[model samples]
Target: MAIGDWSSRMRGAEPCRPGTEKNKGVAVSPSPARRPSFREVFAVPEFRTLWVSYVLSAVGDRLALVALTLLVYDRSRSPFLAAVTFASGLVPYLVGGMFLSGLADRLPRRSVMVGCDLLRLLLVGAMLIPAVPLAAMIGLLYAVTLLQPPFDAARSASVREALEGERYPLAMAIMGSTTRVVLVAGSAAGGLVVALFSARPALAADAATFAVSALLIRFGVPARKAAASGEDQPSPLGQLTEGIRLVFGDPALRTLVGLGWLAAFYEVPEGIAAPYAGRLGGGAVAVGLLIAASQLGAAISTPLFTKKIGPLTRLTWMGPMAILACAILAVTVLRPNLVASMGIFALSNSFAMYQLAANTAFVERIPNEKRGQAFGLATAGLIVGQGIAFALAGAAAEVVPPSTVVALSGGIGAVIAGGLAIRWRGMSPAVGRHTARHLGREASLTGQTPIHAARSN
Candidate 1:
């Protein structure tokens, strides 16, 4: 199958083949017990390498986050500073995105991806050397973030092409789920690594992970050509605008991007929720547990939701819904205890599931050529939205009580998100059909004790 038009446009100067807004619903049943297990799917040589490289990188990312958090906390002795440092990591992602992101489509995906790994390796490696100034440290990380767009696009587009056909959706689903799960596991493991050793050691481990990921991609992934944007097209600025136009041109694309913003919108409560929890006197451990519990819900539930809710489904509604549930759950603790707060926090993870659904729909609907930039754009949107959310939530803490703020934000989210999904469903019938198919498969398979057959006739 040809890569979609929007995808084509993203690949540099070339004009891409156009795409239709065809509603391809997930078939009600996945291939049965005869179908390959998720593990088995990766056994394919290309997939094996991609999996090894990525999962390792994921672990490393988690460790680095841990290290960054600990380093800042130890230095400033201020929790807010640590949060600021973490939030800073997101800034380059937005800033560099508009300019450098086009490289994803312009270059060979394999090369771009490996370069990103190597660059990250260097950035993470530098952290292990204590002499690096904070100025330099932040600079290195910013540079590293800037380089990720092409690599991200390459990896994303590669996944779709690598398993082109029926397996594509499943592939997207698996990758999305794996990232979520690893983040959960990684966060815990990172904390442990930091506690056992120190931030320096954790960062070293992150560098090693990036190195290994580079090696895997260098040696293992089979090369494939992607659709090229015209060679004589506009300047870098022009390319970025082109990418923007291509993405928003379609209704489906517009909705998918909207979903990304929605994820950011409702996510703010959780981003600052723990700090709010801390203010309410939930100690460090309690704050950590609260955040972890929420993410855990997302890690556990999203894949199952993907299987159940197909293309037509939108999770924009759920981000707020989950936030509202979490808020309601949070408020119940007028003077909340750790366990109850943690449980409420856990419920917040449901936004993660919604994000997964949104991403899957996007991967399915958007044209492939533009996928990288589209993803970059999506990432940028999330950063922007999350920034807004973080500020709003923080301000809410100042003016309103923390719990009240969280609950109110969630309540607003629920109404807005639920309404968005309903309106989206009405506007795009394909989304509905796809969602139903995704759900049908999940429900039929969930109770069957797995290994049971689920093939189409």
Candidate 2:
């Protein structure tokens, strides 16, 4: 399928009709028919291939990171260097997302993803060599990590192209929930693998996963031309500038991105889980539980939220849910016990499932040509924001109790979320108007009523 073909069929590509009811001026989608089932989503061969490949790569990546971090600590016995080794996986995202993600738009997405996987496979295999020094290993790891953003951008854009309408969000929910579960399981599995077979085996396993993932993409996914092509295609710098403008220039897109970034606030608990658990007279096990609790709520609730809720209703609840996701974190102020603290974290994350709505809306609004760069920009900002938030929370924890720091973060997030919520409400009418006009034009071209055009598309 052509990229432009999928772009034209994007959900909400058509606008509301003149007589449709609006919720406080926000354009709501018409009542959709029966929601798509997980079985139906999985029935798409491309989706199944992409999903399995994703799972393989994600698990391998986590296991490799854990094994590598442990190897560094065991060799050097320097806690700080070990920590830095672990963090190397994350710090490159800013650079890759900002500078390299446009490759997805410039090249066929399938090519970008497969190339990344093959490159990573080579890098991980290099790490398996006995003569590779610790410093050289770290450098190779950095090189491997740098390839992730383009791969991610390509994969995400491909998924959007593969699934349409409600299937897209449902696919996202599946991936989102799977990611949380994989994080927990992969870490545990990594530790076990290292304990038995050692780090070399773990690294070898990671290299094999990348090889398999590359093969899957090469064989299973249909090839499409780059989204941005032709003589008028923008330069890389031009694409970057356009992406920044496209994401921030629109009121709805900006607000949706803001809502998604609320993670920088609600996620403060994870940053301080160790100290918080210590305060509760708990140990490493407590820290693990605290961290897992944060992910558990989302894993359990997101699928249900997407499955049962209509798209319009999901949009309607997005702001309130974001507010609650943040506000609930303030419960830490009461200094709850370990189990209670876990509950608070879990409940907060359950509400954070609102992000599924924000994500769906953001993708629906972006043109396919700009989607990779736009997603990259959003992802980079999110990573930078969370990194800063974590650093600040850690700093504040030195002066005050972790609970107090968490409460302060939550309070600040709630205030910000409230302002953004109000802004979203004010901007709804404009979105509804714009959507209506677009649908009207499409209807004229199709010789159909606006409502009929909306449904048929």
Candidate 3:
């Protein structure tokens, strides 16, 4: 089949043919198309609204988590209870991603997102009630967190619907970079806010952010029909089963997801950051610096990778970059000091910019109707994998040096990445060919070289 036909089928849209445009059953001259700049992407009203809403919700969620964790510690004075409270936000994701993420495809995506925000608003607001017991507060927080997978799945699918071509990957880059910044800043701000006014006010602020997010999504985002709606749509369980098969059964997709899951290995440093810091004779400040350095490297590199590299090249380099991301961590075996360790972590994470390629390729391959469920399954696996990795790393650290654990993790990850890289290289030519064909068609319509074509040249 022609690449155009394949692309159209994947996106659930009609193929655009050369020398003509279809609009409301009328054929007209094709307009020129080019790669969108970040400014151009932001200029899209829907994208801008979604971006702002995502930022608000992310910051609010982080703030609430920190405040709740601190509150639990203050009252119970048990690090175990506090850790459980903190973990409450993550543990429910498996359930939600497996069962509820189908809602994004079954109902109107806008409705799903807005409804999730409103529900979270109510949940967070309840957390502020003085009569709510500490145990109940944690339950409410779990409920709030449970809504995240569906909301995130909907939002991700919606962003892809809103942006096409290079714009989608660019938007991903923007969001990824912003998330790092929000994580670092939100944690610090949450601590300060809790110190000054206590947890209730932070909870209230979280509720307010959710309210604002709902309003923005409702009023600012353009409504679109759900990708998988109608009486014939499968039940949630059916959808989940299909999603798993779709993601795991396909060799290419399986490899792509494996590449994405490389995080479980390289992120071990974060799981043992405190112990690693102590091993270096450093303090909490060092721990903070180590964590921040990891985020900083991704924040700085992701945008540059997306903006400077073309789509095909990004795909071509994804494997090597992922390998380097993990391989560099082997340097930890040398037991470097705090500054050197931070640099090692930063450089390792910088190579992780390859995730942009893996993510974009995965999105492009999946059918639009199944995108949400597929994304949810992928995310669920990632969260569960990271959870297990952290547990194992922590256990290993108890027996050996944290740096040794990190190096071991890196060495294992590098070996796995090497295998995945070999698999990906075997498959990449087909992807490159499809990309070239797609860009060639776009160039024919646009009367100029498409970005990927120019970059590949």
TM-score of each: 0.79, 0.90, 0.89
lDDT of each: 0.61, 0.81, 0.80
Ranking by lDDT: 2, 3, 1
> Candidates sorted by TM-score, descending order?
2, 3, 1
What's the C-alpha lDDT at position 123 in model 1?
80
Selected candidate, larger TM-score, 1 vs 3? 3
What are the per-residue Cα lDDT tens digits for candidate 3 across 383-449?
A: 8788889989999999999999999999999999999999888765323457557545655775644
Q: What is candidate 3's local distance difference test score?
A: 0.80
Candidate 3 wrong stretches, greater than 4 Å: 1-34, 430-457
Give per-model CA RMSD.
7.5, 5.0, 6.5
Q: Give the TM-score of candidate 2.
A: 0.90
* Runs of candidate 2 exceeding 4 Å displacement: 1-31, 429-457
* Model number with the top lDDT: 2
Error of 2 at 197 (Å): 2.7
List model 1 lDDT by residue over 1-457, tens digit each.
0011012321111222224422222212222334334555665677767767778887887888777777878876887867766766477777766766666667677877888898888887877786776656666666766776566667777766666433444555566666766866898788888888888888888889888888889888876564455667567687788778866766655655665565554455466756677776776666667666766666666656645543323333433443354344445327466677666656665544656545555665555555666767777767766777778888877876676666666666556665555655544323332444544464464432111113322
